[model samples]
Target: MSYAEHFSLKNIPYGIASTQDRPAAVATRLHDLIFFLSDLNLDSPATLNALASIDKDELVKLRRTLQTALGDEKNVSRFGIPVGEATMHLPIEVKGFTDFSCSTEHLLNAGEAVLGVRSFPPASLHLPIGYTGRSSSIVVSGTPITRPYGQYRDGEEIGFGPSRAVDYELEMGAIIGKPSTFGDRVSVNDADEHIFGVVIVNDWSARDIQGFEMQPLGPMNGKSFGTSISPWVVTLEALEPFATEPPAKKTPVKAYLQDNKIKSSYSITLNAEVLSEGSATEVCKAQLQWMYWTFRSLVAQQTINGCNVNTGDILGTGTVSGVGDDEHGCLLEMTKGGKVEWELSTGKKRRYLEDGDGVRLTAYAGDGVGFGECTGVISAAKPF
Candidate 1:
């Protein structure tokens, strides 16, 4: 009955796993063992998305079944699938992925440097701003992030090359489990019924590439390179103990987003590090409390437009930055867009990541680690 808080008997989070000879199957973790859902007569599960599309009642029933099976001493051996022999795959099949801007601190800090403005557009004050990200580019943790190449504006001269400013953004993604029909809307209070869990996301960015192409609409090649995510999906019900009120809103949102009265945040603590040239540097630590738009509210806003949300759709909370310099979420904010070199504990300093720099991020809530580390090392860009 005992396991880490992240994946305990009470928290049977789902994911996809496989051994060399076995096909991909749905699974839940209690400790070292991965309880394969297929063995429970939930056979041949290709992915968690199949279960995600089921009704809320069914989802609850399955969760409870896993919880009960793991709790019973007699059922333990049968459910204990060897986790060491398995490989964890992406938890869900992301049919649609949306990246939302939720941290005012990020906008404020990044805007000044990237856009030469003190604030984001006025639209940010009213509704959640998001862009459809490349679903195909979303890779699991441990994947390498190849530096992207695109046309860059070099003082009015257009040049195509690899980005000089590569950065990592610390964020949490809400995994949508329940399906909603087109034109259906959800309130902030009911959003949880649709959200299966949370996962750590590292939305890698290439400043030079993003900067040049983001003007006409939103990001393009700069963002499509690669985004990394942790393997486990920690259910919200398990995180209920960590729930806390969001910060006092400095800017008010619209009607649908305010249904919860601003109590929709979690107390998860997030941190990022860089392993470069044999030196590991602790970059920043931030909490989800600093997020301007809570996950529930973000869901309400997304569906408010009458857009149908699929079972595996992921709503990403953009860079969760806090108030202090030590709490910045991305290197752009911490270094002021590469204008300042941040000192590392190893006596080295960096303005941006160089080749071979491995970026790893982790989040925690109490003693247990949040969604395992979402890691990606930088590789030199492909040839132009």
Candidate 2:
């Protein structure tokens, strides 16, 4: 259970934590120590949002200063708190969330399950298809996800009650550090300037409700219930070493979405585990490099229609699935829309999550460099 390696000196990811004697405040991690920055005087308004909104160069300077501070034993003694004694909180005050379907493999797999075809709509190749999501439901890791109630088709009759097909979508969330004004567009080349960091996102879903309602429009109640994210926000600079080129586009993109000059994808490995009956079983392993659309392009697409973005906003790279059964991101696809049962190492068979199932997501470039676990346990639904 020790995640100290994820917070090595090489990665000073930012977050917020609270201890018995301290109020929730901005903090950063180095190894197993959590250092609150309120005393560092990084800005007049000492919050992660303020720190994120600062100029990129100034933020870089702050990173270097913290790295240097964490190296000194005297400084560690003065400010560092054992992470075991602290409770992690949501790292950002997210006001908006947009999740994009960027993985071609996931799209095709989902299509095959839901529509009996392993093909994507032509529009998916031309644009980064996405939908606005409920930001208020976003929570930090370890939070419990309540099983949601919604309407669905039960044989020939419409049914209403707790969803029977609760699922999880493994994704990476891009945190917007800088704000953009209304009526202004962000070009792909300048997208990095606006992004602060990345975190693991578990886009909790209700497959039965989603399948019944997602026609003519997109997900609503099925998706808006809850979204769990890692507490640590791994800075973009820390991931520079992992940058890699994304797959080539089969069709050219619009001029505003062009990013031939930038290597916009990272070579991060993603994994999901089902924790049940005191055991953790690895259900899926995927690669972020398989995403067809670059993270930068998501920013470009978000702002292309003059939609303003603000600090703490989230852009989700939806369901980062690769090829094969073991690489599927969600149970809905892996189970072929409930036709097959997924058996965990604990010997429990499930087509979707049961009331007490736990889902944990982890992403990293290498040892000692990772976004710590994004975890959530399912709770029984309230009666309708």
Candidate 3:
């Protein structure tokens, strides 16, 4: 579906983090509001208990005085604390985020483009594939991302340095609320009950660093550097109307991963835009929709190994790329390993991202449930 028809300003996504100006705030497009649970000066313990049970709305408003102070730019004096004081750090206490590799088109394209293979790994066809990523690196959108430094090897020998190939992966992420134990494997039918909401995730990549290290095992430091996510978490209940079937499987799947009652995916439009330093032009626009596996399958398969998952654990959908020329997820694929060039609207060309380039990834469910935006700007690598 077209973007304008589906997304709107009222539907802000939620995220948990400490901003530079306000150490802990509920980020929305209009402004960030500081939430102080301990200092509300409740009439009684029951009032505080009642506040805790009132949901995110009541909790946001109980602290409106803080909001007023923040709005008037007098928060430091009003609270008798530092201007950006945060009594507590943001944690997974509210929601758990997870990444899933459900996009078959992206997996296939990336394999062919990066590994010179035309098909998916046989293991992926039968089950949803995923890996655990660092939740600590997950930052609120609009945060400045520092380029990660790691080891690299272009010619069989490993050496340490700042990454030469940094890229962005366009994907959706899910928030987990209900937890499960190590011995419990949720059936596909019951997966949605464990989910709380969804958010846009920019799983930043250091392709060159990853290429050198990702053999024998999967991504490590290459993927651990940082992950950018939208602040607002859009609830699953809000997205119920947009459920749709995922692309048909080219190969057969195991019974445990299939769900007759639930459709596997949503027909959401995903796009990525890059802004280079000193340029007013939008560098790229990539759409998302051609995924192989659905979010439900990923959740079901995650527990197959008897691994327990908690409320805030994140599962990232790997980069969602399509078959068209403008749909590639990263520059590595768009430029075909830098063997081709991408023409921007400004008439300039790019093979890969340069320092100071800002990348933004956005997505929304077809029925108007917007997941908001995930964005990060690349800074120059620390001087060697």
Candidate 4:
């Protein structure tokens, strides 16, 4: 079958592939055949930055050219490589990463249960709250996450050791395709144009470490260890069919944040599942639309201050917790700060992840088409 008929023509996801001799090749796939973009002279850079560096019109042209080539039988014999022969790498060259906390229920639940607070900061209402994260640690899916060690509050005393509360944050990661110079700002109305695509993010967290260091500042060692992202880049243009109008803001945003054109938030269904002891149980099944703030809102807020953003920078949509327990996005929220225990389908119980456990996150835009799953297996930390 050709790209249009079998691979879902609507989704022309991109990724980096490599063979034993060649460490990298930018390519697109349709079933077992991988089409190297270089064959068509459409892509040359080792990273997606080449695609991002170009303007929207150029992007459309490159995609269109590739689409036509993939549909032609003669082109396949020249550009295609067997999928089994190549290895996948991180899809983009990540220069920076920022994680935004945008779920109302997450903030409220975590604040009350973890910190015993009752109200949110006034600024949180006016802006989307977020913090910079360690971009060097972001890895492709299938990477193993070694549990991290950090200073944690143990009972009445503080101690440093391997974290006991290892967790995974289910999120959608937006990739910045357009670079903005330092001091340049993108308004809410134009934010969508700057976004290239999205990938599923597994922001691994050590609850004990995060909880201890979060007060003085935002996450540090608690979150710096490792983050896994799905290799496929699902373009925003493909999601037009599933876009939804976000709920009316309780408090309207500032003038720059207003954009009637920014009408729909992609309605992607997100799922987080844990596989342990040969058993699998889904922990979170929610939708991206449930987030209190949408991507346009988050991106605009991030650039409100004169911050230069580069192509390949990853921005995460905090945890996508919905209203119910089943809709919760992480163990910290589902267990209510580890106050409860969750039993798996195999009858195994968990307060947090154990070594050898596999955590996977999957997402779909409409009905059942998906961007694939991002997953990581827990491993013991190196000896102290």
lDDT score, candidate 2, position 331: 90
Local accuracy of candidate 3 as per-residue lDDT tens digits, 1-384: 123333332333333434355445333221223333233333312221122233444434433433453344444234333213323222234333455666666677678768888787768878877776777777767777778788887577787778878888877776665677879898877877666566778888888788778796778788878888765566565566667767778778888877785455766777788877545444335443467776677778888877766766566678777777777777777766656777665677777667788887777675446755677798877776
TM-score of each: 0.93, 0.97, 0.77, 0.93
Best by lDDT: 2
Estimate the Cα RMSD of every predicted model relative to the unseen true structure: 2.5, 1.2, 6.7, 2.6
Distance from true location, Cα of 349 in model 4, Å: 0.4
User: Tens digits of per-residue lDDT for model 1 on 121-156?
Assistant: 778867778898988989888888898888777877
Candidate 3 colliding pairs, count: 22
Give one clash count per candidate, in the order shown.
0, 0, 22, 0
Off by over 4 Å in 4: 1-7, 41-43, 74-79, 367-369
Question: Over the stretch 66-141, how does candidate 2's per-residue lDDT look in tens digits?
Answer: 8887888888888889889999999999979999999999899999988899888778999999999999999999
Between candidates 3 and 4, which one is better according to TM-score?
A: 4
lDDT of 4 by residue, 225-339 (tens): 9999987787777676788876667797788767666455878888999999877899989988877778887678778887878899888889888889898889998888999
Candidate lDDT scores, in order, read: 0.82, 0.90, 0.63, 0.82
lDDT of 4: 0.82
- Whose TM-score is greatest here? 2
